[model samples]
Target chain A: MRKVSSASKNADRVFRVATGVAASSPVVFLVVIALIVLVQAIPSMKFNGWHFIYGIQWNMGNLYGALEHKNGVTAAAGASYAALPFIVGTLASSIIAILIAIPISMFTALILAYRVRGVLQWILSILVELLAGIPSVVIGLWGIITLAPWVRDNLAVWLSHLGPVVPYLRGPVGTGLGLLSSGLVLAIMIVPIITATTRDLLMQVPILYREGGIGLGMTTWEVVRYICMPFIRDGFVGALALGWGRAMGETMAVLMVSGSAMNLLPHNLYSPISTMAAVIADQLDSALTDASQMAVHALAELALILMVLTLLTNFLARWLVTRTGRRRSTKAGVAA
Target chain B: MGKSISVTDLKAWYGDSLTLKGITMELDANRATAIIGPSGCGKSTFIRCLNRLHETSPGAKMEGSIRLEDEDLYTMDPVDVRRVVGMVFQKANPFPTMSIYDNIAIGLRLGGIRNRTELTDRVEKSLKMAALWDEVADRIHTPATALSGGQQQRLCIARALAVEPEVLLMDEPASALDPVSTLRVEELVEQLKESYTIVIVTHNMQQAARVADKTAFFLNGELIEFGETTGIFTNPVDKRTEDYITGRFG
Candidate 1:
């Protein structure tokens, strides 16, 4: 080995420290955000106690009303902040988006990875990625203008006919600016995310393994179904979880198409709803009008909740990807 | 039962370049035929063509008339052709996600043999045929990838055999193994020839001599000489065949 000069050694040390900081910046940022949100949410946490999550009411109260003191925190009289409706809305719409996205994304990923080739494959891949790059607010606008109307005039009406078969499919589809519209908009936003990630994962599957399936008399579809899909299972699930995080945290787009339903729960698939993210954006103005500042603290509490949820999902995705990656690497080691 | 294969004027191309230049030959049933050639000599491509695996590669194409016994190979569905002709690659490739039992059972299960007892028996028999039954018998539920490289190769062989193909194509199956494993695979090939028509592509001339009944020499994608292994190794009719067998040139 060549001996390193002291100058070069100092450079190496600096480089290592720099790279380490770059690598850990995300974790540092996450911790700082969590700490700040937790501190800001303390007042709201004391006032609401367990009711913050389970209570259905979410009111800023009249800002002109007399101030009331309770749980060592001051707020406008009759104020309440229950997040049950927003929690349900967030989960339902995101779950609906996931349900609608999985199959479509998988098939699209398959075509991108295996079916098409050359210029067509390149073009399709770029187009899919371009969809991901499009502004979410633009998608929200499209949802308001075109998707909401279609849902009201077509999808909701057609789905209502199946009301006798499925309980959630019942009539009273509303103005179409609700759960179904929010879910559809979210699905469109997440499909490109899931599809692009899945395509990359599918493409990483070794040709040798695929050839083993093909050589064993499996049809092309069978090869994909039995071999390719199973090989990429963990990575694919990680992609879905990543997309789930994005859907849950999405604000502007979901807010626009969500019909901004507040203080109530959706009774059916077509009923209006509001996610935690949408609620934060939609209620901030009125929340700021509360002179006691309790409303702002409550919004901070909501941010804390959203942060924790997204973090959990992101951690789940990382864990899944690492688990599969370690297994694949070990397998490769043995083979080599 | 093993089926004979006959080829006439087979030509293959990878994109615009021709790799196999109109070669023709016949392979007998229930015998191991060794295709000996250097790297890039189309030995592997020729076997890939038999199961239509060659066409699966991007820009790869072939022009050939190959008959599996009385059946035209090209006319049959590629999937059906692959069923009658299974291939083992130069590198071992057992499905990493599967257990040893599942690895062997996959081909059969997908082929619609869902009876549990039948699947178990076939898996056992295939493992035994590939000479991997004893080592892996107790640990059949373990991941197939946990096995050693040579065992994984045998596992792949067993995977192919479980499908009950009439012809087994080994593309340098033992090239990646140690001396001991190579000898074991050669012995397995000798044993397997009693039931299946085996076409083995190898760069090792001694391996061809040990396991093959008939040997074909491929150079620049042409069938230079083909005859009894003993005769080709000893008295080659073609000068190029003698040069290759005697280690004069690839």
Candidate 2:
């Protein structure tokens, strides 16, 4: 605890300053990029007013119809921004991804952490660790090349085999690059991330709780169900949200598989889709008309909405973690 | 009523490394038996084996025969043994997720008790048995985790008693507690002996003399000596027991 000499103190200050800047550089860069994106997105949106967020119809030729756009609500700007499709795509894909990924990841995590404990566990864990290293383009390319065609042929074959029992299986016939295919690719991509995170959380469960439950005559599975699962529920939720956020905003893989078709009320699994990021990527370049520009700008707004939702999920998980923090110090607040 | 427990040729192995070497002792009905030994000498392991709790450790193994009134404990079934014999840990381990009332009711529900009135009566009775009813009666709905260290320990005792087990195994139940709570637990152990056969493992030798009717001394996983509390503490036949008791060696 004693103070160092002035020379040592100066060296320490220099070292601290260097380390602080190095550590914060990545965060600073990310913030700057986000700010830039926000700045670019705002001006065009402000010009469109409330109609920018609404109005389903979109066309380029109706830009300056003077009678129609008396207050500058021109038909050329004819219902430029309808965020409904992108919003639906983002939410549907995210929900589908979460529903498919969470259970698979949780079970994978549990198996890795508890059932398998030696070099096998380590190898599998390393494989999951390696998943994060796979660039998004590789996954997008793989989905485009391998998954799409397989889905089409397999679903047709599967639907034919179960013709009477299931009809929807037949309906999503040859259009492999669609909502369902995109969801499948997203699920596969998200699982490794969720698994790795949930495995870490599962590992965080104290040995004492597992011992306590088993000592009470609970079976191994029962111990996991009642004690281990409940103890780390918040953390598992955090992991799911992490995966969900990543999947929801994923641009390249979704674009490769989503078939790039935008329409209303996407009920069909075989139906082509376009997520917010994909629309921004695909349409932003060809935004020659004012309406097309506004439409692309609206996709950026959707990105902001997805960010807020992800942030909200993360905050709630963190809150639950704080609320359920079990410890010795917590006891002093009450007598019994 | 509490039942007599007979342990014969009890040996525990932690993955081929012998821990408890040939421990044979008879615990009398409605009496407390304190097992004393140095840390890692298998006193705790031996106690946990009575309720099949030793299997909690990943590599722990057992080769022994323990019986509660002719019913073989080691072979009967872990669930049945757990039902018949309950254990309290060295550190208090009240389920943090449960309320005080629910903590007591855990055993009752585990045993398949469904009636609300029966659950209430059993919870009340168990809490009273552990001397925790008066302190926790009103806030029984409060999280059991909200209690003090001593209260959590007592709640665990109450939890064990809730199922009306014939024998109780306590593995240094007061080690993590304050002196006042230690005294309370000791007093509760004495009171509990009226209807429950008790086996306690304690690091404190004076505690053995105070509450234990019979005392067993273990060393390096071997049963060194066991007899009346007075004889084991004052007139031990084995030099090892004498050394352990008189602070000659751990």
Could you say which candidate leads in lDDT?
Answer: 1
Fnat of candidate 2, please? 0.22
Q: Model 2 RMSD to the real structure? A: 4.2
lDDT for every model? 0.92, 0.78
Can you write out model 1's per-residue Cα lDDT over A74-147, one digit (the tens) per residue?
88999898898998999899999999999999999999999899999999999999999999889999999999
How displaced is residue B147 in candidate 2, in Å?
A: 1.4
Q: Which stretches of candidate 2 lie over 4 Å from their true place?
A: A1-31, A46-79, A153-174, A288-296, A312-336
RMSD values, in order shown: 2.7, 4.2
lDDT of 1 by residue, B176-232 (tens): 998888898999999999999999999999999999999999999999999999999
Query: Each candidate's TM vs. the true structure?
Result: 0.95, 0.86
lDDT by residue (A1-336, candidate 2, tens digit) is 987899999999999999999999999998986786676566445645565445443333354542234243333434445556666777777777888888888899999988887788999999887886688788889888988888777854565566456654446354788777788878888999999988888887777656666666666777778777876776677777788778877999899988887655465666678787787787766554554355445556556656666778778768877786543233422242
Error of 1 at A217 (Å): 0.7
